[model samples]
Target: MSQHPAVTFRSAAVVLALALGAATPAAADAAPRSRPGDAVRSALDELAGGGEFAGALAAVREPGGRGRDYTAGVGDLATRAKVPVNGQVRIASTTKTFTAAVVLQLAGEGKVELDAPVERYLPRLVRGNGHDGRLITVRQLLQHTSGLPDHSKAIPGTFFDNRHRYFEPRELVDLALTQQPLFPPGKGWSYSNTGYVLLGLLVQKVTGRPIGAEITDRIITPLGLGDTYWPNPGEQRIRGAHPRAYKSRTGEPGGEPVDVSEMDPSRGWAAGQLVSTPRDVNRFLGALLGGRLLKPAMLEQMKRTVPVPGAPRGWGYGLGLTKISLSCGGLAWGHSGDVGGYSTRGGVTEGGRSATVTATEKSLTAEGDKRLDRFLDTALCAGQRPAAGQALR
Candidate 1:
């Protein structure tokens, strides 16, 4: 397993202190609730203190198949808007989970074979890289092992100051093609927004429809996920009432903490463009894991990949879904999303109980990611006691 850059125990201690220190008052808030509710509430409070996120909203499905919603903090900072139990926000990479679902649906219909070579559709993408772009498969792209670079640079720096601008999907793909291959197709794992954008294009080609249309026809409408949509820059503004996402410009060279409530969908494009509420995320994930979406055989195939030890969820792929082991005695199948000023983590237990929390903070820094994972862990593992670390794998 590739370890994250080592942090000295002292630094870790400082972070832990910050996390636990924030938890104290939250724990107090939960004192009036039942143990399970208290656990969930405590976790939400700790997550809210991280400067990047404005709020955390969650829904945990019960064994009897009922779901409960929990929310904390203000959704929008300037207006002090409370995050509605049904408030929608940018899903970022959580859109991958939906993307994967559509692909799996196509696979089931025999429209696209997961193992087929990509040369059939995108012949020019890998032409000169000493890599057989033909060797790249849909499955590899979904699994993040396609050896493609994360064409984030495809997004112009100027757009960072004005994230509400739109760019065509072709423009994003062009940026990816300009970069060198990170590795040969199927050789290793690297998170590549580029691969998914291509996958989205393939979905368009194979289905003879836009990716958004197919997702709506196949997944969203059927699931009754009324709050989810594939939005664009024109539709960038946060609707109804929700948290205003903030980005840390703390150490950025002459940058101010930017409010990111109106970020561009083109920045994420197909890789992270979906917008949804916490309740909808929970519903979609829970339905997927509960065998409501994919067939038993296909679901098994999706869960068949290798596990990345010690990561929150051991890595595996089927379509866009990922497998993760919770600190509690459960395995969750879902995806995490990060884009501009939004961060989302959501999953459904193997048995179909689900939990999800979305925050408005997005940062590449170690501290930021750790904080996100901690909040997700708390939401997913709420009632259960922590298990031996072995289960984390």
Candidate 2:
């Protein structure tokens, strides 16, 4: 299991959540000017202009109560327009944390039970191909221990092939049923998009409302994340002054960039389909870790970590969050995600430091993923002393 940082809450980080306290009016400012985080801005510039991505956006809050929004590269490859500061982008799997938070909140309210069998809520909906709802618990699904096959396999072709197709929640789950299980419930771990879809179903079953609305009422509005929102069903275009997401022609980093920002993200429902900005994402994360979103007991449950096999050393998965070791010191707890045309990575430290990066294209190679991790890690550890040779690029 990943180790939690020794630092606790009630620190400066909680200060951010107190005022809906981030993403200012200057968030639309043009690219970097002479100021703090020059290194962070330079790093983002290289990533976007170096042929790895068409554009990138970031929001970083330091330990001393200072924060800034940054943009790099072009927003639209066709126009060569500037990237919007703190632009909105599809947040992908990070939505898992929102879904998990609602489930945990429901569990806290006695409306749901963490250990209850999936069959208890949805009743046989999760049966087929060695998978059985009777044997899977709510906790298992939230934690990716349900042994369910990922429904992404059911998406037919590449993401571009069905950018406009809408998928029903049950239809996605049934698609996973056509596949085999990864392991018996609670016996192992694997990332399963299908499991979170079941969670969406459970939330609907228990609350009698759509999962998106639950997330909005329970989390977004409370945090005052004005730049964030759940995309309505069949919602294809991003709703604000955001950067255009790009797809690589060869499906690899450095390949020719193609615009693919408009997409119907039904395939990622309950697992990955929310739109948000770096500042909004940072604010939401800080609020979540600050006790505004869940009761203390439930937050603890969200912090419990389990080993993620094949993940980097010191990497672990919690209910819907990620606990990863930082370069400066200690650990950061947040999630990273990818969708059709965007990739985002960020984390809030135990001490209140946080940073988020949104690249307009996904990393198609392991090396590219590492570069993204390195840049975000560099941003979080900014203004701190550097190691012997690990200074920001």
Candidate 3:
């Protein structure tokens, strides 16, 4: 097997220090046991205290309920600025969920077939290294069972030295083609950014427009996600009031954190390049689960899950979304994203409650990851303590 690094963080923590100089009105006097957002704010406070994060934000909205926002720490460590309450963030691989939603919508419209061979649209682009385009289906691509290697790992120096370089979608796919397949198509499950890149190409082929435009027209604009956007090529910085992002020196333990807020996002392309805020993310997910994005059949198909053995327990891959069993005893649907200088996890419960939590630091230690997971679990569970012996999933 190839040694490609996993795109998501393997683990995360929330330090117990309160980094915000002043508490927000939404968080000041509420008890976590009484309010879900209060619980999330408490968790964020814990994470910011350990010095692992420069800043963090959490936003939650419940059905027929008032929305609440919470924040901890400073936006910039150098300047000691507060993080913007609803600032735009890179949002990394969460873009896949949006991409998959668009593709599934096309399937509903009869513009594309879910099980159709990718060769039908892209022709010979997927040919190479024991990979056959004729055998891989569009469903497999969105489900991440196409056996394709991640281009980020397949190509050396794609992220570090070329952080500012812009790449066409085809070029990114070509890099993955240079590596051997991880497994025959549909034989096993593996996360492949290249597979999603191909799906983006297929979307372009069918729609005659870039994936960004389709996502904007179908998902962003319709859902009223005003703060969400796909950055244009050569656009290297987040556009709104936002916290600075930091990456560990070489993304390893004990390395100095470096600011990486200005890298070009084209390197992530359709797979992971979209930028959004916690509130916007919650709104999108809420609308999705509320049946605003896809037709009934297509939405059900998106939730059809397969076991992800390499991921945390109770975690399953379904189209581009993740089905996670919460510690408080229920299923939550959403995705997690990690890229240079940022890490995010968010989800919506079946009853229409949504929450998103973000950290400014990219490279998280094991403890940090656990804390982040706990925050997600605690927030979604709606202030209900996890059942005894139950842990964050």
Best model per lDDT: 3
Model 2 ranges with Cα > 4 A deviation: 1-28, 34-37, 63-65, 253-255, 386-393
Candidate 2: tens digits of C-alpha lDDT, residues 98-190: 899999999989999989999999988988778889999998898878888777766698767877899999999999999888788999877
- Displacement of residue 361 (Cα, Å) in model 3 is 0.7
Best by TM-score: 3
Q: What TM-score does candidate 2 reach? A: 0.89
TM-score of each: 0.84, 0.89, 0.90
Candidate 3 Cα misplacement greater than 4 A, ranges: 1-37
When sorted by lDDT, best at the front, the candidate numbers are: 3, 2, 1
**Deviation in Å, model 2, residue 101 alpha carbon:** 0.9
Clash list (residue pairs), candidate 2: none
Least well predicted 10-residue stretch by lDDT in candidate 1: 12-21
Model 2, residue 2: distance off in Å is 20
lDDT of 3 by residue, 154-243 (tens): 556635687788888898899999999989988888778788889889999999999999999999999888889999889998988788
lDDT at position 204, candidate 2 = 100
Task: Report the lDDT of model 2 for residue 329.
Answer: 63
Return the number of clashes found in candidate 1. 6
Which of candidates 2 and 3 is the stronger one according to lDDT? 3
